[model samples]
Target: MQSIKNGLVFIAVFIILATSCSKVEDTVIHHPKDPNTTYFPMAIGNYWIYHEFTLEPGGEVPTGKIDSTYIEKDTLINGNLYFVYKSSLSLQWEMIMRDSSSYLVNYLGEIFFHAKSIGDTIFREVNLNPLGDTIFAQYRIMHDGPDQIQLPAGVFSVLDATNVQLFPKAVSGPKERIMNNFYAKDVGLVFRNYFLYGKQHALKLARYHIEK
Candidate 1:
């Protein structure tokens, strides 16, 4: 009886996903400084290979998605220079991010750009997309300096930052989200982990090409 009920639930979710909206939220990352000098380098021709891991709603195992993201070029928006990072997840799907500051902007949302350091806690501005909304983003430096961590991509000393997002009514039973980013100086992001909908998802830098 329990197995039958679970099967029905799975089928229902699959149907919903198959017919879901074609438009996805845009994610924007803004960085005004030279990517070459920042924790993430933004030289054209530079590329990062990322492995995405998504878990089943109630499972601990993960499924992989995505392959590589290349820093193709830079564009001017509102007279502001922004680096473009494009991720071709599949033949039919793509995700792009505009790096302005440490903040990223996408069709999904935007994070306010600013300087950050260790032990700094701040409430920054965020302009999200899809619904085209603005809100405050609260961030904290969970760890700074050198954090030696290992990922499938490689091992590196990283600068870690954490953010907590609250949702009034999220999926099923979740109401909050926690995201942590591990950035490798020069190489950019090494790994990222987040908990959403009571499930854990992650991304790791598998390989990279940085231009001189």
Candidate 2:
């Protein structure tokens, strides 16, 4: 019975995803800064998706929905993106939902970019785990030209998607599934996705967007 319901939920997400608007292209865009320099892509007051992990394994998964919101406050001297946010998980069928309302949270971390000696690889370092108060960080490795950025095709990453990674790994449930849709004027409305299994749940997405 529980499995049936969970499967239905997953199907619903995809159905909505199929019809969601496409990503729009931005002719006026900014390129990434030099690898030697730290770049802050998020601006103060901008809201970004923090993340929601909803994968449950080896048992009946709950019917809780996870959502996130971020407000960029300041960039640290080290070039990390810092922001304030509120996240909520709602178990509509369970009474526990009332006790777990969204709360304000603070995060300070940097997106470290490193240029390797071979193959022109880029490495990103973040604080890592989001649960242990260790600061949240996600990393991505991209293949690039000496002067150009190459990222998986997606609206969320078109501008800065050069090997971008989202942190707080999604292991079991719905969150582990790589399905996304997002829109922005600069990057335009886009569809992006990621999926991971077992250990090394590194996530990546193909860029799809709609632009004028």
Candidate 3:
């Protein structure tokens, strides 16, 4: 009887261990595949505050300002759901959608950013002056790998996206425009540099909140 009880106990212990191991294996198998999605997290209540500065033409002296951007709510457009984006700097609201493939798309079907994309990806081309129609711009997004960037919100690994003028050629005087946006995993945008005409506008992350 003593030996039988010991054997039963051993079987019970083995069953418990097997169950635990199975659970661990399941967790590993179900782990998230696209971590890049965290680079541009989209959820209601997620917000970022920026310290904005504008530099004078051909100079590094910057006049500072502050602005914030946040996700207000979710709305359906064309049978697809998108988050409504708002900013303290502008009254205009934008509709943003994210797919499982890590692409951020606007309501107009424009690709804002692709987190997994490499090299140069042309997402938008627009005529700056529609009436003029001759002054055109091309917006490109790319991921040049990862780098460590430091800000008021601490240091984080970030991805980069750049936008530049393709037509009319970029010059030093007027009509020159270039923009760079940096995004951190699970943290959204951390820094931005927008140079237009002869002035430079920069934004650095001041603080942020991500609602999981």
Candidate 4:
């Protein structure tokens, strides 16, 4: 009788542990920057706060920096990168006339955002400048589940401001881009740094939910 009782207790403990572990695995956490759209496709028309820039070199590790705080919006028109903002024409003119050897080009373009899957994460990409041979930025937002969007909590911000002045410091005023995503609710959006140089210098930056 004593042996039978001990065996039963051991089996009960094993079941409890297994159940606990399963529960932990099933918990879905939401991110803050997630657009809050999950069932069907969602068109994101809200203004985005442009904050950081990630830099990559030819043969070194990628780095990120926070240089400016500008707000902009993207308009979605028939799945096109369509939107416009003010231009720093004076600066562009100065560069064109004053510095003939300048590699700086004023960026004044639109964005068209779409949804795509990377592994298990649902992300949306915004084409910052989708024309010509211009170097533009892209954003990616991640989701937690089919109906929940997680905010940035454990996400770290890169604080290297010196990078913005590497070249002639090309500025094109405020700009906006249209973003569309199916994971708008679950996954907000994503911003990726593609090392035009190599993958060894690639890095990613994101904004998720934080429990403050």
Candidate 5:
């Protein structure tokens, strides 16, 4: 009886340990084997310059401008490492991102872009408010395929990832926002198009420097 009781206790302890380990494994976020293959490569000193333009109201005429984005540095946040990103553009000024094999995720684990196994419809939610209440933005991957694009920098083969934004119920504003980002392998974002409130804003890659 003593031996049997000891065996039973050992079995229970083994079960408990296995369950705890499974839970820990499920919570682990796996990093990619090769971060360079991601749509947006994150590394300090890598930079991209864009020729930004906005269509004139009720017309197709473009107001020529310029903008730039670069990886400033890397920092540890919430126990995870993320590359710091800065841009001269207004809409996306600063953000921290990391590659997670199939997706480029932000500090909150919200996907910034899907990198692999893309299907017809991939969706994610962005929290506009810190508490994740009241305000949110819905993003849907509208396209993922091969295409070619021309820009001031050069012409190249590219993979297109278009994201459409759906307005949140708590927000009172324009109902439509669409952003299209074209990324070339090795190089980062080559071109982008943003449409909102009857105006179209475009950013065409003018120059870039990617560190090996």
Candidate 6:
């Protein structure tokens, strides 16, 4: 009888250990970023604030414009749900969405965002509705692995979404522009470095919240 009781206790302990191990494994197996979005998180209530400035390369960067951007909410446009953001430009809206494979940035309703892995490249010429304005964008996945970046708010392990745009002189503001956007897992854009003509501007996150 004594030996049988000991055997039962051992089985019970083994079962408990197995259950604990399974739970740990489940945690490890879960994805790091939100399942719906990666480079740019589109959850409701997620927002980013930026300090826009103008700087000459290897020179002083005097603060110019202080810009703040945030996602207002999710709205269904033309039967498709899109995360809308506040913008100064007079367009339909600055929106973002996710498909099965990747995140898409709708610059005034244009599907211009692309690239997910290293060595990936996306090139497109998107047209702004009714204005006859055209935008040529070329993007290459410079880094898709683990990387750390420091912002005005904090440090982060970010996935970089780097791109360059060839804009017409009418819209390019007398120079071309490039953007190196840094995004954290589960968080939206945390940092961005914008280069136009002979000036550089940084958009650093002052604060952010990833909606649960």
Best by TM-score: 3
Please provide, for model 4 over 36-142, each residue's C-alpha lDDT reduced to its tens digit, 9 standing for 90 to 100: 22311222221211123222233323244321111123344444433222112121221010101211111222112222222222222322344443343334332
Q: Which RMSD values do the candidates have, in order? A: 11.5, 13.9, 20.0, 21.2, 20.9, 19.1
Model 3 per-residue lDDT tens digits across residues 1-212: 01111111000000000000011110111112244456777888877776655554444344556656777788887778788777554556454665535777777777766767757684867676646655667667676523555555566566667766545634534453556676776777777766433445566676776786
Q: Please report how far candidate 1 places residue 90 from its true position, in Å.
A: 6.7
**Full candidate order by lDDT, most accurate first:** 3, 5, 1, 6, 2, 4
Clashes of each: 22, 18, 1, 27, 0, 0
* Per-candidate local distance difference test: 0.50, 0.27, 0.57, 0.22, 0.56, 0.48
In TM-score terms, candidate 5 sits at 0.65
Worst 10 residues of 4 by lDDT: 10-19
Candidate 2's residue-wise lDDT over 20-109, tens digit each? 223433233334423432222233332222122234455433223222232223434334334432222322211100101111112322
lDDT of 6 by residue, 1-212 (tens): 01111111000000000000011110111124333456566775555655554444354354755455556667776667777665433244354554324746453443333335545554445546466655443443444523455555565666555565555635425334455655666556665565444455556565555567
Error of 4 at 209 (Å): 11
TM match of model 6 to true structure: 0.59
Cα lDDT, model 2, residue 133: 42
Shift in Å, residue 36, candidate 3: 4.1
**TM-score of each candidate?**
0.58, 0.27, 0.69, 0.24, 0.65, 0.59
> Ten-residue segment with the worst summed lDDT in candidate 3?
10-19
Model 2 worst lDDT run, 10 consecutive residues: 95-104
Regions of model 6 farther than 4 Å from truth: 1-37, 57-65, 88-93, 96-100, 107-115, 126-137, 140-142, 166-177, 196-198
Error of 4 at 166 (Å): 31
- How does candidate 5 score on lDDT? 0.56
* Local lDDT at 129 for model 2: 53
